[model samples]
Target: MLDKHQAVQSHQKKSSRQKLAKVLLATLPMLTVLGATAGLSSCGFQLRGYDTPMLFDIAKTAVIIEDNRTAFPLKLPLTRRLEALGLDVIDNMTLADIANNSNNVGADPIAAITVNNIRFKRYELVGVLTEIRLVLSADVSYQTIENGKPVTLSNPIQVERSYQYNEASVSTDDQQGNQIRDWLYDTLARRITDQYVAISLPKVAPASANKSSQTLKSPEKTTVIVPSS
Candidate 1:
């Protein structure tokens, strides 16, 4: 009778081990998925937000407008965005001071000059003045005073924006146009910041820096008006 009871206890232990193995096998896939999700979260996977990081090198910057007629509308929005990036914005910087850094007395500051041109063209659809196409072209350049000499960090970076006309409601069309304008402003500002980050930032590790350097390129040139001192 004792031998029979010992055999029964051994069989029960084997049965318990088999049950636990089945349970672990069933949950293995879920555990793997959870682990992968946690790993991605730790590797900088994030939902996009408005407060994106600014990784530019310079601390203080001045925005100078060459054409007030076309670029004036964007001034306030650009200044606000630059300030949001924790930059020291100098409102009184002139275009002459940007091109030639002779007049800057104390610590030299970086300068950005924006020249804009806007045009509207009317389109006739089936013999009716149905749509208007508004085109805004902007050119932004950057200059910095390094060691008592002016250096052109970036040439004129051109950004163009346009949208189709909606003639259904006057107010709605106006609002849409304003929205597009705001989007263009934001896009231009982002492009400028990206360019600065690409050129100025020091090289990091081989893998990450190489990936970032691929999206960067040089800018072009444009004429700018000199503001009175």
Candidate 2:
């Protein structure tokens, strides 16, 4: 009876895993297209010989944590990575500062990298040798300002990473945890930087009625017009 119960449990877990895998597979195509469009529109089609690597097509940018209550440490690493890619990092900007910077004359419109959510998950496997799995996931979006109005990217970046370790090693658990955190931070930052390369800056004038008073429209189903081979 115990053996039968264990087999049933194992089958249930396998079915759950398969279902999750299918969902991920279905979303992969959409995510791929969106990221490609982001890099091209934001970076102005580097494939055509443009030589700039800044993700937002803007002179200055700042990273903001949308929810400060979470105590997540992703902002600093992401900022450093963005700067390394040639973006002008404006430090010490508060959410209030970002809101108030709109529509000012000669003011460099500040683009923002906003992180919306962060989550951690853990799974423990029981066997002859027990194992543990850890996952870190974050949802992020970018906003570009044109003529002082904000246009947010429709497709947000979702980054996830998983790590596994032996459950018996209680002595090294703390060290392993720290290592996983750092690894997750690095991976998150790296993927964010990479995706930004495809984005293009909004046109400076932004086609307003008065030329100066016009607001930019945020794209919903942004598509890339790829050249035919």
Candidate 3:
């Protein structure tokens, strides 16, 4: 009787594992779907049907500097970013080419833009010797060709960053300052790109108008059900 009881206990444990396995198998597909949905949502994935307008519709573009003296740090990164965005950045174009409108090649038009008046300012914090605010400002102008006439759109972009001063460690503070400067350069470059793109893109319709149109097109439907005895 004891041996039989032990055998029954072993069988019960085996059965319990089999039941758990079946349950897991039944819900595995649902768990997988939920996980995939969560991952996609977290990464901000969206369907790709829209065309984002850009400053230079043409494949090639020339970035000219009206005042090259103070824009050295910004020029290289800006050019690289433009190239990364599928623009063929022609750095070899001279100022004369840009001025004469000769940068525009036949059939393949070249968009020319100028960046100037780059300036940097630092302000010390009141009553605090260990902190400073840094400001970077620059002027951007895009030359647009309309009816064989050149039109320019100019805008100013500025970015500010604050850094805490460490009086104890001069080396560390200097290193941090350099890092901040590089960060400022990158931020300014990205802002300049974003401003241009925003200006160039077509204006989108308001959400309320879109909702009204959608409501008019497809009115909501309702269904009613009755219980029978």
Best by lDDT: 3
Give the Cα error of residue 200 in candidate 3, in Å: 3.1
TM-scores of all models?
0.49, 0.56, 0.61
So what's the TM-score on candidate 1?
Answer: 0.49
lDDT of 1 by residue, 1-229 (tens): 9999999999999999999999999999999977755554334222233122334445667777655555666677667655554566777777766545545566455655444443323333432334434445555566654454556653555455544554654555467567766676666667766565455443334544544555455334568999999
Highest TM-score scorer: 3
Ten residues in sequence with the least summed lDDT for candidate 1: 44-53
Alpha carbon deviation, residue 60, candidate 3 (Å): 1.7
The lDDT of each candidate is: 0.58, 0.65, 0.70
Better of 1 and 2 by TM-score: 2
Instruction: Provide C-alpha RMSD values for all models, in order.
Output: 19.4, 18.3, 11.0
Kindly list the per-residue Cα lDDT of model 3 for residues 1-229, writing each as its tens digit.
9999999999999999999999999999999977755654344222233333223444566877654556788878888666555566786675577665554455555666677888889987755457888888888887655555566788888888998876665465477677888888889888876665554443455556677889999999988888998
Q: Tell me how candidate 3 scores on lDDT.
A: 0.70
Cα shift from native, residue 22, model 3 (Å): 32
- Which is superior by lDDT, 1 or 2? 2
| Model 1 lDDT at residue 101 | 52
